[model samples]
Target: MRKGILIFTLISFLLLNTPVLAQEPLNNIDLQPFLKLTMNVTLVNTGEYPKFIAVNPTYDFKTFREGDEYLLHNTTDLIQLSKANLILNKRVGFWIYPHEVLKVEFSINIPMDLGELYLQDYADLCYPDYTITWSTKRITYPPSLGVGPLCEVVYPHLINYPILVDLTSFIQVRDPEIVIYSYSGEVEFTITNRGPKTMFAVALPLIPVDAKIYSITPNPDMNYTEYMGKFLPTYLKSQVQNAKFNLTQESVLFEYTDTLLSTMSSQQNLIQNSITTNEDIVDYPIWIVVLGENSSFDIKYKFQWEFTR
Candidate 1:
């Protein structure tokens, strides 16, 4: 009887000292409906280096919660160093947060004069997947709801990357832009040695809407590629059987075929395959794919595109 009373007393004493969810950290996060990018930099050597490589154009902004690390795409054209010298420890945008303008930077092997630097040689900024975590709870961002864009991601899933975001139709929303005449038979272009010697010709590869092509009418300018095959259409479709299933959700991400030829599977009209026409996808995700040349040279271009859309 004495032992039982002693054990009960000890258990009651332990329970009294423990605290519950009443004192737990509260999560007061008011996530904005829109997403933005931001960056911050602390230069170790201020005036020591005159000019260095950078990634993004000015006027990019973001708001990230504390302890977020973003993966930045290191652009080759942004650096104008000696061919032998390499870049090291280059960092872009500190952490994106709401209402913060971001600047980008890179660590270089040759800390040369900034005036001797030329940013025109830098290639497009490319990046893979990145993550952002909200460490602090109170983040303020205004919601922005705009009209949906008109263009679709034209690249096949395997070869899709986006260097530009705004749609071709959307470009008309601006003024004083150069008119790109692409529908001509040949495009004549002249590349110049602005800062560096001629190493390679740069041109943006075009992704076809459907895989097959009857002809390619290049612009009147002279930018060219060597391995040009007769244009052909590639096939992509989320294939499905004419049956029902209880657990089809787990299996059907999407299926596609390579041969999108015009051969009829049925006696119906040859309807252009619509990939994102599902009734379920009320708000479809945006995908962009960019095809570029593989070269070890510096090139810039202003080419026009004309296609029978």
Candidate 2:
């Protein structure tokens, strides 16, 4: 029994000293740099196996754009994400086997008809068995967990601030067409703040751009000092080029939200704000400008009209 115990101890020591891997463990799990994707191509085998997509999965590159540049997005759904959001899910594959090297050989028809080329990637370090190596050997997986999966954007320039603000209706020129009619009607506005955070109150507006000449005369919505509760210099109506509404101090009111808010929760806050109406009754106008597709058809903001002429 003593001899058997001694043999067991010796074997345990040898096992502990045994090398687990031939080299080192690669820890980086992101796949952006090593990710090479191709669209539109014909297959040609190099010799036996010139290239092998390591994860042991079969993929067809034949359906890709043969010579044209194809844009790559990081989603499996293949849809675009907002410019504000940059992170993408993993979209890379690798082969397994700790020591065996497999290769897939194929000939590709590289025609000049293709435009620019770009690629997006991610690595899977969940299992240490997966590995991908290229001839240049420039790309690598970092040996740490917290290392960034360095994201990149590549494509033609396009839209900005893309968001779906939903459908809303406005009654155009209630009193009268200031330029054409004798009377205009009032378009009562009640803006609702659906956000948990206090909807940031800005100067005249939280608009995409500011007006140069701005407001001139105080009409219906253009009454900068009256409609807009705060006397901010940046108020667009204050500089207005003005409308024709006879101003009244008591006619204005302060509302935190819209009058008939459909999809917001701040109805109570705005209702409360309306109660103490002596000083802050005045609120900013909902200024908007409509233009035709033609660049020549541009106009300054048109405020809601009540009546004055």
Candidate 3:
């Protein structure tokens, strides 16, 4: 009777410790989101036998049925997995035996940068069929471009460039005066032109790497009337209705011409000749033509660039 009671207690303990299989089918499961491409998953098998879970590959990722530490230190295992051309689509199971839980971790070597990645596991035990979805969040950014010191990240993310221009002459323009800002896939250049010249035609020589030049429109808040009044007053004569400009792959050119007028008269004994051009002229990527003899203007140009990959 004592032996029988001890056996009952043992069975009760086993029942309490082991994970119970759900009566209904487990169709879906969501895993924790990770920042990096690699993640570790713990799969529990409460079924009667060993089952296979097929992982769907994303971004041409390869799978190896090995743990992180073992894959690194164990050269034999690494070579074996490397040579093993496991059919990605048909690659079945990181085996979990009955009443057992297995922890499997894997890494993906992606060809290009990824913002967020979604991974899945299709596990069908026939008895309890299920699918598990895992996602990675863009919480952190690794230096995927390169590990070198000079490596730059130029994705269409939130970025700002502080611009300062103080030039007595064009030769003193050693740095750029325009600041490029990209937010929510829209690119904008916040430009402030200040110096001793009436800007006629402005050009941006260098742009962000891998960014294509496209048509840009002035922001509505920007005072176009005031802009033309200070710099190209000649454009007003032509009845400038709207802001117009052109761009090239390498440079952004302002589609406006410089206007100059001169009047001279030679009569009998007295002769008078006058040529009007501002002396306070400085050349910059942003061009300006002086409107008056003592003309000096500070203009701000804010425009947006629309582009794709």
Candidate 4:
């Protein structure tokens, strides 16, 4: 019995000291760039005999995109992960042996197409208030209690905020009509405010080359369309020419300022006489006071050529 015990100890020492050889079938676990956007993982059976193993990651096995290509670790042989039947059940082939690691490398590509609408939603879904989750777990059969078998990993990553908010969701443009003939025409359209708060001034930026404004007026919508045109054509023709200053590349601004009021303080004010209540405060859609949250209004821009064609 003592001789038998001595032989066992000697065999154990040799096994411990001997380095495991790389076999023809490459029996070993493999991972590429362990910290990567798409992690390549596989389990190999280094032993000559077949072994049963399974991966039970916390993530749903089917979450991977379809048609992604996988490989048998070091071999040129290609495999399609989506075609693997066992993966749907979150298990590995009972016969998976040396050099074969199940490929879990895949990217989730979520595309947004709604332009500014997408930006608005992205801003609301980013950072401290929201977090997306990803996790994984592993299980091996022929269970050895507490020896080496089960494992789990999970985490949450933060999203970028400042860049997403700068996108164009706050300003909206719609239904514009411009007809110019012989260097004279009218530009009309309604701009809507889609922001959370009130807006002071909105830019109308379109002006014909060397054109002098004839008149600017607000045509009320169906709610109050019966009232006569709120602006005096003769008076507005002058105010607009003076106030309709343009800056290259920037939008033309239609502003209501007290600076323009200084000239009329001693005379009858067009704003006080022609423009009274909030209805007249902003023409049809262009707001003078507060373009309250998400409101639509209109502005009529009429112009004539400074040098007649």
Clashes (backbone N, CA, C under 3 Å), per candidate, total: 36, 52, 7, 11
Q: Where does model 1 exceed 4 Å of error?
A: 1-166, 170-173, 180-256, 259-309
Instruction: List TM-scores for all candidates, in order.
Output: 0.17, 0.14, 0.20, 0.21
Give the runs in model 4 whose Cα sits over 4 Å from its true position: 1-181, 195-197, 219-289, 306-309
Ten-residue region with minimum lDDT total, candidate 4:
26-35
Model 1 is weakest, by summed lDDT over 10 consecutive residues, at: 26-35
Q: Write the per-residue lDDT of candidate 1 for residues 133-166, one digit (tens) a residue.
A: 3344333433532324432322222111111211
Task: Report the C-alpha lDDT of model 4 over 2-90, residue by residue, as the tens digit.
Answer: 32333344333322321222321100111000000122222233445544434322111222224542322222232234346444355
lDDT, candidate 2, at 104: 21
Error of 4 at 31 (Å): 50
Residue 164, candidate 4: C-alpha displacement in angstroms: 30
| Candidate topping TM-score | 4
Flag the better candidate by TM-score, 1 or 4. 4
Question: Which of candidates 2 and 3 is the stronger one according to TM-score?
Answer: 3
Q: What TM-score should be assigned to candidate 1?
A: 0.17
- TM-score order, best first, reads 4, 3, 1, 2
Encode model 2's per-residue lDDT on 1-309: one tens digit a residue. Answer: 432333344333222332122322211221111111121112222233322221111221111222321122333235332222122234322221233322222111111110111111122334234344433534445466453555322211111111111001111112221111111111111122211211111122111111011221122233233423332224332342222443354333333222321111234232211111122223343322221221111112212111124
